[model samples]
Target: MFLGKVVGSVWATQKEVGMEHLKLLLVQPIHADGTDAGTQVICADRIGAGQGETVIVSRGSSARILISKDSPVDAVVVGIVDSFEYCKE
Candidate 1:
């Protein structure tokens, strides 16, 4: 999983049947301190996250399985991070 910020939403009136009901969001990866990590990704939002919210994104093949038993999603927003904790050495 990765930490990211929900930047915007995507709207499509017509799409594949399996992807029709899911909400899509443009997410940019971010550091724990809330700084941009210079990478942007579009993911299916399973948790209803909004813009500016810190979210947790599941990636790769497992991401799809996590959202649904039979989905083709490559990435998905699984949770919203209310607070972050990291041990700095």
Candidate 2:
């Protein structure tokens, strides 16, 4: 799994029939401190995450399993992180 933020959205009216109902999102990878890491990817949203929300992504076959144990998804947004606390030095 990878940590990321929902930067934008994606729409595909002509996608595989099995994948038609899934929502797609553009996710930017983020560091532990919540800073952008210069990497971004488009993933299928299994959990209704909105723009600017920090999320957890699962890639490869595992991503598909996140939606349905019997279905297939190359990448998926599984969780939305609510908060992160860092201890000061």
Candidate 3:
């Protein structure tokens, strides 16, 4: 898993059979210090995360199995971070 910020939402007019109940968000990967680390990614959200919220993301097969066995999801929002203290050393 990794840290990220929910930058936006992805809306699809039509979705796959098991995906209709999920919401997608555009997440910008962030470092532990909360700075952008890489390109944005569309992530499956099941915990109602919103824009600008700090979130924890899990990727690949582990994430896919959590949502569905046959989902095409490569990334998913696992948690909404409540708060954190960054101590840069």
Model 1 C-alpha lDDT per residue in residues 1-89, reported as the tens digit of each score? 88999999888898665787889999999987778987799899867899999999988887877766577778899899888787767
Candidate 3 structure quality by residue, lDDT tens digits, 1-89 = 99999999999979987898889999999998888899999999989999999999999999999999999888999999999888888
Evaluated with lDDT, which candidate comes out highest? 3
For model 2, residues 1-89, the per-residue Cα lDDT tens digits are: 88899999999888775687999999999878877887799899867999989998988878877666666567898899988776757
TM of each candidate vs. truth: 0.86, 0.83, 0.94
Clashing pairs in 3: none
State which candidate, 1 or 3, has the greater lDDT. 3
lDDT of 2 at 1: 85
* CA lDDT, every model vs. true structure: 0.86, 0.85, 0.94
Give the residue spans of candidate 3 off by over 4 A. none
Top candidate when judged by TM-score against the true structure: 3
